[model samples]
Target: MVFKCPFTMDCAGSVTSSCLVAEPLRSTGGREMLRVHFTAEDLTRIRIRAHPHPLWEVLLSLHLLQTRRGAAIFGPWRRDVRAALHPSGDILTTLAPPKGYSPDFLTPFVDSPELDDGLEVVLSTSSATLRADMTRLAEQTKLPSWAWRIAGGDAEMMRRLADRIRQYHAQALLPYAHVFKSHIREDWARRAEMAMTHGLEHVLSTLHPSIRWRAPVLEVDYPVDQDLSLDGRGLVLVPSFFCWQTSMTFADPALRPVLVYPVDPVIGWASHASATPDARSLEALLGRTRATVLRVIAEKPYLNTKQLARATGTTPSGASQHAAVLRDAGLVNTQRRNNSVVHSLSKRGAMLLDKPALQDRAGYPDIRLSNPSAG
Candidate 1:
């Protein structure tokens, strides 16, 4: 069986079609794909991460920094991160090479999506696991003496590696969290809505062009021929901002099953400095605070008064007032969920954020946030 993309690649190796990234379509034949076998019970068990996984982002973004594969998309962010990197960033780049095996211990599962939790897990990696993973990595690429110490489960080496990972995350990933994370949140919202309205099957089938749902199996574009049996453990679909071109799974099948797939590609959102310009433009139209409120709502829909206030750095009453004004203007919708008022962007509001020009074209009402009496 063969899978083909409808788009053609241009001289720059970019897809002419707006729908997909180039790599998946670059070579359709003789490409390896992962076939995930699922049982009926497993179907019910499939889940999606609510937010970006910090360690996963750390690993994948490091991969991007070392390679020029997705320059069209990751170029700006790469340049910015490189400028901000400490000399210690080399430790990460060395551990996670661009085109080969990376020690699985670098990205261990954390109970929560928080970076601190993930870092704790990394620091606590079992001695046997570290030696085994480093041994596997050694087979493919040369490791430095420091890396060998890590394999030996030397505490100081392990701590140094964790510290470097933390530094890289803070330098490269944290600053741009709003842009990429907002995109991931949007992806999650869409997936959740699809699951609720159509069914889980629809969500899986439409995940990406490179991933297809065929009855009991999910075929994914991958670097190697592999099969994962869900055997009722279910699978977590993690939408990643730094993961480019294709979806990937754990090299060690014994770990919990996960599919880290790239989210929908939006060119402007890919840049590290994009959020500032976009926010500035919106601030020019909407007052700074109100615009921030709208963006926060868009990122995490169904935010309650308290959560919204916390996110936007405003008081609860202030958040309520802004939400009320947006609600009155038909730009936001409010509903009672679990006895708390939650806010989300209405269709018109989403359109405005997605295409700023649409507000002019649609002739949305002039919203004045300067009025002291108005929210």
Candidate 2:
């Protein structure tokens, strides 16, 4: 049975492909219901609005729309939002993160192990019923995979859909706005006081309802000194997804400072070291010509042979030879753009650049050594 979706069809012509799905009628009993789902692509799409730098408003809205509880609260009104945002299909993609920028940094606050466990407890108990309800809706809707493709071909539809989703989500968010607002307000009010004592950009408190019962969760950006000293107390760096923001713990006095990277930095660090060893080792492995080519591509992705040769002070033929060596080593990748071949890091190459080396330690075998040169 192929029935036209009452909602706008995404570029792929899937009626339910839109960001939110709204069900208008109830079955006999006076129960109202709606369903919302935010994919990783959706998060990136909304990020456009918050672009240039972090936009707290967009971040807060996205946080609510992406979570299970928030989806339940706003599900019924999704159609209204679709109407407002006029969403199309261009927002989704499988593109990996860019150079020097770690996607791990952008992960949400919930990614922490301690917080994840607490959230599981809440979902299994306090929010168990809501989860069940959403699961049912998910099964009933069963949107097709091709729906996401709609955005690729149509720009207008994409803009419209994005706008409508933003508006609708904003409307659905009103009731809970006050709660988050108060939380943000409390954070702002204490910012000055916390800064005076703790240092700049310290975590005022974690807003998760589960952990709020205990002490307000706190975080600090980069420590006051790069030496990783927090007045002799060890710091606990918590894993997180949100970029530029971190969750950390510090006591008043005495111990080694603990630095935590949001994602598993060990794997990333090792991969990076393996891919791009020190200049001398790299020169020895690939010879100076190939080594220079690797360095150029590592510094600037997507450079053509012409640009590569110029950058490396070599002829085009020499650069081409070196590029072949890199490609053979599986260290560099190339894409043909018209007549030009643009070179960039392959997955292996990127991982090598990003992953540092692991340290030998007791219990924490996964921890990577910060300095590869240190014994």
**For model 2, how does the per-residue alpha-carbon lDDT over 76-141 read when each residue is reduced to its tens digit?**
333333332312212211111111111111122232222122223322332333333224323434
Model 1 spans > 4 angstroms off: 1-30, 270-375
Query: Which candidate achieves the best TM-score against the true structure?
Result: 1
TM per candidate: 0.67, 0.24
Q: How displaced is residue 216 in candidate 2, in Å? A: 39
**Candidate 1 structure quality by residue, lDDT tens digits, 152-256:** 899998777776775566557654666666687788778767766667667888888899988789988664456788898878788888887767677777888
* lDDT score, candidate 1, position 315: 74
lDDT of each: 0.70, 0.33
Error of 2 at 275 (Å): 11
Question: What TM-score does structure 1 among the candidates reach?
Answer: 0.67
